[model samples]
Target: MTRSTLPIWRRIEFTVLLAALTVGGGIWGFVELLEVARDKTAHSFDTRILLAFRTPGDPSDPIGPGWVEEAMRDLTALGSTAILLFIVVTVLLYLLLDGKRRAALFILLAVAGGQVLSSFLKLGVERPRPDLVSHMAEVYTLSFPSGHAMLSAVTYLTLGSLMAHILQRRTLKIYVLSVAVIATLLVGISRVYLGVHWPTDVLAGWCAGTAWAMLCWLIAHGLQSSRARPLD
Candidate 1:
């Protein structure tokens, strides 16, 4: 039988298993990347990839036309602290007003906790911003895992999964989830294009951020399964 056709409890068990696997894999990938990032042994690889986005001789001039740079900056802002906070608060308020208090609280805890965790990781790693190219976008924080990348994944993925859960149609659910993934990816790429993050920084951000989101889902699903009937 297809997974969706399984007994409700069986489906829940399968989902929990998949999410746990994802969390474990993400954590493992992030740790391996972290060691490379810490040792600076990946400098050559990082530099080569970073420069690929710039003109052959001009690291200051990103490879795109002027408008493209502006566009990337705009894309990058979608992951900014201000934008993410606004999105989270808006969603939280909507969920509360709609009587989904549990969901609202979960979103708040997931995003806010992810933000705090990202800060701790950055501070602990103390990796410097990439100096291989002139930064096209302004930045003030220390760089290890790109904050924009990690937070975007955390926020968007959490929101996406919630959206998937709410939608009635399978296609609609897939569409929303795809949009979330694409948005998260674009933000990471924009950071590289803007020369604000090393390639590994973005990779680590994606790994950790995805793990955090999945971890949140696993917790929520487990709690819900415990409280609800098996048929639910």
Candidate 2:
């Protein structure tokens, strides 16, 4: 049969395959980054990127107009714990009110579990914040994998995927998913630019978070698909 004639379930099967590949890639990337995090090359790379955002003569001043720095700070805040919590609570409330109690609970648990995972990874790695350049933001935590980057990816991607499932229009679904990806990238970049996280930290965070989000999606999708399948 031609592509246009393929059943919707076939398309869903393709998506499941793709998501599985993504999960594997993300996990592999995270592991490789973890292995190299303490090496000389990684250190050099991290410092070079961190200092690139700073003025040549002074690492204290970022290489940008004042407003640029301010904007970066604002972007980084999008991934802040407080902001993320607020977003989650709002979504949970909406889902519950809309009689999607199961979805609400699943989302809450996913986000909360992601938060816990991030914390555990931080403790396991115990990497210190970058000191090669002046910090543009205040931080008090280990920095192997950036919590901002990881949590933002987890929260935004999870919400976006869920929203896409509910949205009827293909265009709307794509737009929501795109926004989630862009938001996650911006948050990670902001962390590096602010000299609070090493480049590797953000990369590792992205890998771990993407893997986690995709895994959750796979599980949920599988459960729903099984329920919808007709008895043989």
Q: Given candidate 1, what's the lDDT at residue 232?
A: 22
Candidate 2 residue 167 Cα shift, in angstroms, is: 2.2
Model 2 scores a TM of 0.90
Query: Candidate 2 clashing pairs?
Result: none
Q: Mark the 10 consecutive residues where model 2 has the least summed lDDT.
A: 223-232
Deviation in Å, model 2, residue 217 alpha carbon? 0.8
Off by over 4 Å in 2: 1-12, 40-42, 228-232
| TM-score list, all predictions | 0.90, 0.90
lDDT (Cα atoms) of all candidates against the true structure: 0.87, 0.86
How large an RMSD does model 2 have?
4.0
Residue-level error in angstroms, candidate 1, position 100: 1.1
